[model samples]
Target: MYMNKSHSRIISMVALVATIFVMLFSVAYSSGHVNHHCNDSADCPICSMLAQCESSLKSLGTGLIAAVFYAVVLSQIFTVSLDYKYQSVQTTLVSQKVRLDS
Candidate 1:
């Protein structure tokens, strides 16, 4: 099936938005707010920052996977719509044989 320019643009936008959101989320997580390590084991900005960085990496990975899944889902929906629209191409009505009286 042929993809229109708008459909391709929408797909690109989805990817771009996902990437941007994930990047922002990672940055926010790495800023020490998401992983403030202050217990008996460790209590310092460096420790907090380290934990935050680790969490950020994990979050980024998860976000990437989620984005891929969503993109695939959207593509499938688009494909299904395309298939429905051109379903007549699958069978030729003019080729159907009919008796004079049935």
Candidate 2:
């Protein structure tokens, strides 16, 4: 069961990376091969590719924003949880069961 989950996670991570690469490549390719003399025709290949690149970039931007938001939220949650846990079992004389000599 654990192995199956791990495999899925790895596959998902690879897929996400591949998607990022494809989006970047599309944008780069479109920019490098921009159609300077576009006649606003319906059959313009470069224009179509550029449109797709723009769409991909927008989706990537949205994903980035959500990822950042989630990362910040998760960091704060883990920080609070860890701080509370440490405080509960913090090292002190009472916590260590020290006996007074007096």
Candidate 3:
């Protein structure tokens, strides 16, 4: 689907902000130290697995957020450039028409 210049800019800004907020929250949540008390051998694997899972999830979340942020910014840039190009062409066309009508 295609969106107009203003609409696309707003959407991109909102997405970028949302992604940054999520990234910050995830980083903070993952940085906090968790103390796990394991009494038996069987419990040790569970605790280790849980930690590993959390770490993996944090890494994945960070990567995904970064990707989204970059994508949004790039798209915004592309849209703005397109709009500028379009306006320039329109102005040139109008000037040529005025000259011909004179």
Candidate 4:
């Protein structure tokens, strides 16, 4: 579990890069428009319903993407913190062992 300071730094940098990539991707995808075609018939209940449904789905999709992006970022952070803590504990244990042996 113990990782050198350099290794930890590398892992952090990678995580940062991944976070940025995901954010950019999500933004690009969300900003793209969705094309829906409906007839121009007066009193067409189907067209009205379809438009409402399309709007609702688009909103839902955006919300889902945002949620997923946040989740990925948070999980990466949590993993890095856990790894750092584990490394610290291992280093402490090794130092203690060395002193005891001496």
**Highest lDDT model number:** 2
Q: Write the per-residue lDDT of candidate 2 for residues 6-78, one digit (tens) a residue.
A: 8999999999899979887987887797745677747988777777888888888899899999999999999
Q: On a 0 to 100 scale, what is the lDDT of residue 63 in model 2?
A: 92
Measured against the true structure, the TM-scores of the candidates, in listed sequence, are: 0.43, 0.69, 0.45, 0.45
Query: Ten residues in a row with the worst lDDT in model 3?
Result: 85-94
Kindly list the per-residue Cα lDDT of model 4 for residues 31-69, writing each as its tens digit.
442343457735665555555555655666797799999
Write down the lDDT of every candidate, Cα atoms only: 0.73, 0.83, 0.71, 0.67
Steric collisions counted per model: 0, 0, 0, 0
lDDT of 3 by residue, 41-101 (tens): 4657656655665775677678889999999999999989888743454556667665565
The digit string of per-residue lDDT tens for model 1 on 19-65 reads 67766766765664644546654657666566666776777789879
Distance from true location, Cα of 67 in model 2, Å: 1.0
Full ranking by lDDT: 2, 1, 3, 4
Candidate with the greatest TM-score versus the true structure: 2
Residue 21 accuracy (lDDT) in model 2: 94
Using TM-score as the measure, name the better of candidate 1 and candidate 3: 3
- Total clashes in model 1, counting residue pairs 3 or more apart in sequence or in different chains: 0
Off by over 4 Å in 2: 1-3, 85-102
In candidate 3, the residue pairs with backbone N, CA or C atoms under 3 Å apart (3 or more residues apart, or in different chains) clash, namely none
TM-score of 2: 0.69
lDDT of 4: 0.67
